[model samples]
Target: MDPAPARLAVAVKAQARALGFDACGITDASPPGSAPHFANWLAAGHHGEMAYLARNAARRVDPRKVLPGLRSVVCLAVSYPGDHDNPPPPPALRGVVARYARFTDYHDVLAARLRDLTAFLNGLGGAEARSLWYVDTGPVLERDLAQRAGLGFIGKHTNLLGRTLGNWCLLAEILTTVALAPDAPERNRCGTCARCLDACPTRAFVAPFVLDARRCISYLTIEHKGPIPLELRPALGTRIFGCDDCLAACPWNRFARAGRLMREHTRADLAAPDLIELLRLDAAAFKVRFAGTPMARAKRRGLLRNVGVALGNLGDPAALPALRQVAQDPDPLIGEHVRWAIERIEAP
Candidate 1:
């Protein structure tokens, strides 16, 4: 028979599955193994302009720093469908969006379920129990925590992937004072695989597991606010939002399957957005169109900045007129990229 705490852990995982989480595991709240590597990565100043990562460096590597009396972390995953296969190329002027962002913001989709699970844990532990949950909002090193909970292993590209879940999954976690049985930690299964590194457009991977965010297309198109580097602009290709080339190259994806949680939230429009159409989005239109999607993270100017880069990379003369219209954008950031696009299109 399972001990009382262990029985509660089993119930928690069952409740997680019932709540539409595709996978769940539990692990004691000790600092994860990735802590040392994370510190080194940050110290090397590889996180780029994302100052937030450096700000919360301590809390991210150690869960106890964020939640007192933390006993166990309930790690959960909701897998996205096989979105990275070599699908037919989008028609001309259509831009690429990262697979996961094609759905309504995953943070919102998973937050509700995480709350309910935390409530259930607190209920099972009676009035004295305390629980906290996060769906990508917290400072925790989510992938490392998930790996420690046996949910998946960190791949060579530094993204989490599972033997079954593949790389197309979003993660969530609950921290609770209630003790739960810990699952066996998952070990690296990516022995000898470096395909993900080879697939990167910007050569962001400095080595097997190290990523230089400054050169990553995803960071440039999304998190970066200033003008993208001139040399790297051509490598942006048609990816207007984030890049999935690395994730798509994983061999384990052959076993990947879509989960139910985010299926209903998928937006087909994001699969292949029209670059010219996106270039014309005014601030209000941008807000309305991407109101509930992760694309809003880039803001209107940032997205338009990316749209300009994509148009330039596509080298399609059809985009020159639209590029010229935005050449004098008041944002200066957008204007600079639009001028660059116009020049690229009109170049000999």
Candidate 2:
């Protein structure tokens, strides 16, 4: 390895950490070659109705397709540490948003940081060393790239798990023309660990390293556009936004250290939200409450739909009045879920 690229890589990584990135690494920007697997998963209907995942097959598999002259990928991870114990939902209430959605949207925070990093890299050179950034919004296999860059190993749960940051981190990438030295991929650290697989209440993980998105609470609540399947409703419990059982069960989290001031970015009202308060929100009110948070992605109807499912799972007669009110909502989908909850509440 020439001293120039090595020295530059070291400095860039240091600068990334100083800029609030939890971890950073560089790797050649080659196509992931995971297309066949992704295609098979799509073919198997594992992605459910997420047509967008199947739409950009070529661009997603090949970074070069998106940026023709890309040479290297700079993978970065930002930690979102939470100190609260995962709280049990109130007995009769509904609508429990995930903790990650409590704070400001990660897309905004990470994109700004990526822009600054891109500007710094550009200042290191000129147009000859250009870069493009992505923060979960782009067609990128961010976890694969991050793993190839040695930032972390993909745990059995399929979430990227950093040695010191665990799985409580967001991934972002920079496709650049600069030819930085690449880091070797990290070794798999999850040996004989089945905690995440066993912890999933819905059995979303069909096997190690494979997830059936349709059964995943995160996909069901947030990504799925229609009423959640009846059979899966009970399994959803009070998780109205996304599920974190897999990530929370990972042993690596025990070693996760607290980040600096950036910790404030992920910690807010999301620790354990009030179900009744969230269930009462109208579209306008939902927007105002979530504001810049990721919870806004679900929209009011989608959120209410999940909340109804949670109410059904609660089996508490006290939730009947709220469920009855939501059952009359104008949105047909929300009304259907609320009706389902009403039936459940009235059942023996």
Candidate 3:
């Protein structure tokens, strides 16, 4: 409520916009109302293999645990262009990557921008402005903070959505010692629209605003380490890296446009990649192709596993040769999925 800190907060938001952030707002580093629900979600095994979410549970509920003197949290959302950010369902065997992964790794891109923002905020707040920042990597509950900061409301699909920014955003945060006036939280405006829930190929949403990661295509393709569940394979379709059906299904995306930074980060090769080409990637080839992109997180075998599922769903038979070559892959996980694909494709 102090004038000096309020002025600094306004300056910080302006600097963030200047640095290409689509939205910015501030909230106190207090415990969020959703913390108990998050605990229940984790206790019910909804987080899947992302054990880190549970490991840092305390810090996530209380930002003070992450930064001992934390006072305010700066929440930011940067939207990527709709063209590559909202890729339509693939035709036949064409593989689809999530909108976020189609471009360079956002961690790298957003980190640099956040660093600059941090420096500017520190300068404005004087020596008392100690800060810490991260792009989706820390114990911070970013989406919850963003909602409290008024950047957007959490949609029924559990992704953040703004009137203008939609759900196509990469969230990042800065926890600072400076006491900035907080923005009122955005009210949930999703109403009864069930488009995101209906659009999910795997039906991962257990209920409104709740996601079961174990059944989520994005979690299976990108986070799960072992073979994907047999029943879920067919639903994966041709998404080899990550899934975006829910995010793309949101009507708010109609307002999304290609900003200069987003356009520069988009990679043409990642848009509608041929399944055959991706299935052919060896460990070496996979690294080279996805080096700077978000897809690299899947590693060679993880990606190959998803590709096998796509091939099976493709049922094109043309992918048989590719599947056969990896049938005996040294990695048992990849080999298992490849054999499943062969069986599915060979099924009468």
Which candidate leads the pack in lDDT?
1
Misplaced by over 4 Å in model 2 are 83-95
Sequence-dependent TM-score of model 1: 0.97
The lDDT of each candidate is 0.90, 0.82, 0.87
List the candidate 1 regions with Cα displacement exceeding 4 Å.
84-89
Model 2's C-alpha root-mean-square deviation from the true structure amounts to 1.8
Candidate 2 lDDT by residue in tens digits, 220-278: 99999998988889999888899888888888999887565356675447655666677
Q: Write the per-residue lDDT of candidate 1 for residues 1-348, one digit (tens) a residue.
A: 559888999999999999999999999989987888998899998899999999999899899988999999999999986654325346799888888888899999998888899999999988989988998888999899899899999999999999889999999899899989899999999888889999998999988899999999889989988999999999988888999899989999988877887888888888889888998899999999999899999999999989988898888998888888889989999999998888888889
The best candidate in terms of TM-score: 1
Q: What ordering of candidates by TM-score runs from best to worst? A: 1, 3, 2
> What lDDT does candidate 2 reach at residue 185?
90
What is the Cα-based TM-score of model 3? 0.96
* Model 3 lDDT, residue 110, Cα: 89
Q: Give me the runs in candidate 3 sitting further than 4 Å from their true place.
A: 83-92
